[model samples]
Each structure stands twice: as C-alpha cells, then as structure tokens.
Target: MSFPENKLTVRSSADLATAVPYLIGFHPADGSIVVIACRDRRIVFAARDDLPAPGTPAHHLRELTAHLIPVVQRQQPITDLMIVGYGTKEHIDPALRVIDDAFTATGLAVRELLRVTESRIFSLTCSNPACCPPQGTPVDPTTSLIAVHATVAGLVARPDRAAVASRFTSVDSTGDVIRHATTEATARKAALETAGSTAVFEAGVHAVRSALRQHDNDTPLTDDEVAWLTVLLTHRPVRDLAVDLTQPHDQHVTFWAEITRRADQALVPAPATVLALTAWRCGDGVLAVMAAERALQVDPNYPLAHLLLQALHAGLPPSAFEQATTSTHPNPSIPNPNTPSEQE
Candidate 1:
C-alpha cells in the first residue's frame, strides 16, 4: 500500500492517496526540502532524502545534522526549523495563537505537553493494524518495554517530572510515548510512587492529579489495588483530592478516614505496615525534613530523595532562601573590640 507523490497542498490528509509509503516535497529558494513521512503529517521538515525514518537512529542523526543551514544564514526564515536546516523547515512556524486556534478547531498536532497527554478516543478510532491483527493497533504496541535508556535519561534530566511511574509490561514495551488518556494509568502510578510511598499504612497517597484526568467521574475503586490506594492516601487532605494545594489544610481528614477503614478490613491485617505508616504520615514537618536529609546522607542514590531536595531548595523563591546561607565575617584589618585577636 504505497502512497503516491503529491505536488499540491495537502490541506488535509484526505488529499493523500497512498497507503504503503508517501513523499511530500517542499521547494524553497535555498534548497529543495522533502518530508517522506512523519508520525504526523503536520510535521514537515527541510532536508535531503538522506536518512532513515523517524523511528530509526540514522534518521534522528540526519534530523540533527540538517539544522546547520539557518545558523549560517544568520536569520531563520519562517519555515526554518533548525540551524542544520530541515526539509519541511520551510513551512513556517505557526504562531502560538494560530496553533492554539488550530488545535481548538481540529484537535490534531502533538507538539504541546498537554496535547501529548490529552485523552484519546480509542474506541472511536481504529488504525489499519487493529483489523489486520493486533499489531497493538499501531498506537498501542504489544509491550511498552519501558525503554530503560529513555527512562533513565529522562529521570536524570527532569527531576521533578521524572516520577517513579509504572505501566503494564506490555504497554511499557509497545505503547506510544505520548500521554493519551490510555497512558494516564501509567503516569498516575508513577506519581503514586514518586509522590509518597514511604509511609506504610498511613494513607497519604498524594499522587499528582493525573488521577483526575483518567477517572474524572469519581469512578468507584473497583480494583483491590485501587482500594489500597484510597487507604494509602489517608494522610492527604480532602482538598488535595483534586491535587489542588490551595485548599484548607483539614480537608483531607475525612477522605483519609474512609481510606483507613477500607484498608483496616483486609483479610490479613498488616499492622506492622500500618504502624510504620502511621509514624510517617503523622510525623512533624521538621522531622520529615531531617529524616529526608538523613536518608540522603545514608544512600544518595535514592532517586526521589535526591530529586526531592533539589526541588525543595530550588523550587523556593530566591528571596525566601537567598539569605539562609548568609554568614558574618570578621575584618582582618580592624582590631576586634573584645580581644578576639587570634583569628588568622
């Protein structure tokens, strides 16, 4: 099923008639640009027909190399995407407002983080592979093989967002890296681990609200694991249910109680876990900080702990902590008023 070459504007994909492969040629005054195909049709670039597809390592290399043209040119044209220059780079960077309007109208492009994570309508859509055989529907792969390389790299780069997340082994192997609602479960799991899992039975399941996006209607906790989650988040305030920190401090108590009661009824009660968790959840803030620092001292490899301190200190306003390290210095040239002369 090869797609045919097109010389005219593809106002929409409907204009494209090929199925196997396709070529979209872009001619600029500087050089002829070509986009053989992209994950999305909207992403055209400028370059020669000299690389593998986007999924291949070779193609990525070419993509990086082509950006040099613009740097040589001094000023980037509307279509310029990189300094190396790209094939479809001539299309013109859409204005932020234009892109927003386009998204509002068609809901297609995968450029924005939120856009990358928006809910997907899996049932409403079907890729060629869905009927062909479960090639994981092309969208969802057979296994999500949590690209260890990619994950580790991302974790290292983004300490705050790099969460201790989870995904079904299969999805982690094959699913698209994008965040469609289908991926929300994975993201939420990561938040659960990263947000707070140290406390055993004390329910402070303070996951970032990736939970709300996936199950916004307040769906009942059907899975035993989910019920456990309700139990774990007992330490969180009811106001935090929305992951909103602006709410009053006491809001989460009731939610925590319900969670505790559910967890309390497990066939085999895990009291040890509960007691340890109780200490964690009810512990004072200063104690938490000291414990956190001590944990760092003990084993600096703890991913969340390292990131925690980074976020804690870096996330503060400059003015708030700028002077915390201030120290008074004695002047060597001037004599001390009270005979403290031994300082060298």
Candidate 2:
C-alpha cells in the first residue's frame, strides 16, 4: 500500500524495513539506516541493528564503481554531456574521471565534457530556539545557509522556485519538508542527492545476494531491477574475465571491454593500483600498460605500477620488471642529467 505524501505512514515503515533487504548493498549495521534503491525505486531502512560497522570510503567506492556505475550506464549512458552537482570539491575529481569513463564507453562525446558543479553543504541548523532567528552574526555554517535561504532566496527566488516546483512533481513528505538540513533525514536524501548527484544508489545487497543464491529467484520483481541485480552481483559481463578477477559467477565480457576500452595511460593517475585492478578485471595487456604509464605520469615513483611495467617488459612476473624500471628511473639523489624526468 502506498502512503500519502507528508506523513510517514507508521504501518508502512515495517513493510518497508522488511522489503529493504531487497534493495541496496548494505549488509546491515547497528546504527545506520540508508536509502537502498533497486533499479529506480528506493526502500528506507536501518541496518539489522546487529551487524558490524558500515563499509569504508574506499571500499564503498570500489563496490560502487564496480557495481553501481555499470547499472546506471546501462540505462542513462550519457557522459560527455553531463550536468552533475555533488557532495563537495574533494570527491569531484576522481569521481568525474570515473564518470568520464562510464559515459565515454557508451560512445558519448567524453573528449569534451560540459557543465559540472557542486554546492558546499550537507546539513543546516539554527542557533536560537526560533527556527527563524532575528538577523545577526552567525557562528555556525549551517546557520549561515539557513539565513541565506531565508533572507535572500525567500525574498527573491520564492516565486521563481514556485514555477520550477510546478514543473516537477511535488513528492515532498512532512519528513522531507519539516526536516532541517542538519537532520539525518535531510542529509540522507535531498542533500545527498544534490551533493552526489553524479552517482545514484541502486540495488540492495540484502536482496541481490539472496537472488544470486539461485536462478529464477524472484520472478515477480520488475525485470529492470532484476537485470541490475544480476549485473551488480556478478560484476563480469564475461565469465572468463570474472574468473580471472576471481569472481566465480557469470560469463559476460562486455563489462571487461567497457572498462578496459578507456585505458589510454595518458589520462590515468599515478601508481596505478586502481588501474591495475581495472586492467586485471578487464584482462587487456595493452590497456594495462597504458594505465601503468598513466600512473607514472602522475608520479614516476609509483612502485607498484613500476613493478607491473617491469613484469610486462620481461614477459614475466618477478624482480625482473621491477629491476628494469628501477635502473631506468633510478634513485634520483646524486642525479644523472641525461636521464630526464618529468621536469625535463
């Protein structure tokens, strides 16, 4: 049953919680509740309240890039021409690169991208008891956003915002409307949406993992959600590459091809640990070398990429490659002027 807007139908929460295991990649933790989306629909739920802590940032990024991006790419698939507004500046750089690769694979005009922006905010709060305190000096940042939105936008953009609002459906619930930006409810949705608009959450761990246990699992679910679950869990468009990546699931090479096709070494970051993973996943030596060089471009001192390059050079996987790279770009202490580095 659907709950009407503006109220958290108490009855709905229970069913929603029970259904959440069917949405995103949360193994469930004690204190965290997340928005898990299966395809385009989302289920709101807290972790089992019994599991361990949620995943780390790097871990989350790996899982997301490996799982989420593929699914979204399958759908929207537009890159070179994107309009994204995300969390803050720091995540934007690597994030944009990932986005660039995702869309570019779709044959989108990634060489020349356009229009990417972000806002510096996640939460807001008030200093005094009154939600709208009299204008004065503000001590907190969120307080400042509230003041700005209240004093400036309230006066100037209210009418304009109304027109925009009219164009889109107003699905705002009381939870969404009254919730202050500082509240978890706010940070979890609209704020996160505005900040990380570049990457949207899809598929629930609780559900997909269950689905993977057997074929013809839940026949009743929408085909789109099921398709995404299949891809997210397996992660290999090709069975052989997945086997190479040590994923014992499916056989679909498209995943490897799409990921590897972007390996142009000239554009990747240094010390290609991430790139190495990408290459291994895709199993393309040419892309691997390109990625290795790309890493060196960021910092010639990348030990791992250097080692990998050395291994490839010798057609072996031992000290041979490492030794070669070291000799060529030896310790730059005393310095041999002939062997120019990036500075040269």
Best by lDDT: 2
Q: In candidate 2, where is summed lDDT lowest over 10 consecutive residues?
A: 43-52
142-222 per-residue lDDT for model 1 (tens digits): 122222322332211111111101100012322232223224543454565564544221122233132232233454333
Model 2 residue 1 CA deviation (Å) reads 66
Candidate models: Cα lDDT each: 0.26, 0.32
Q: Candidate 2 lDDT, tens digit per residue, 222-270? A: 3333333323322211211222232212122223222222222221232
User: For every candidate structure, what is the RMSD over all alpha carbons to the true structure, in angstroms?
Assistant: 23.0, 26.3
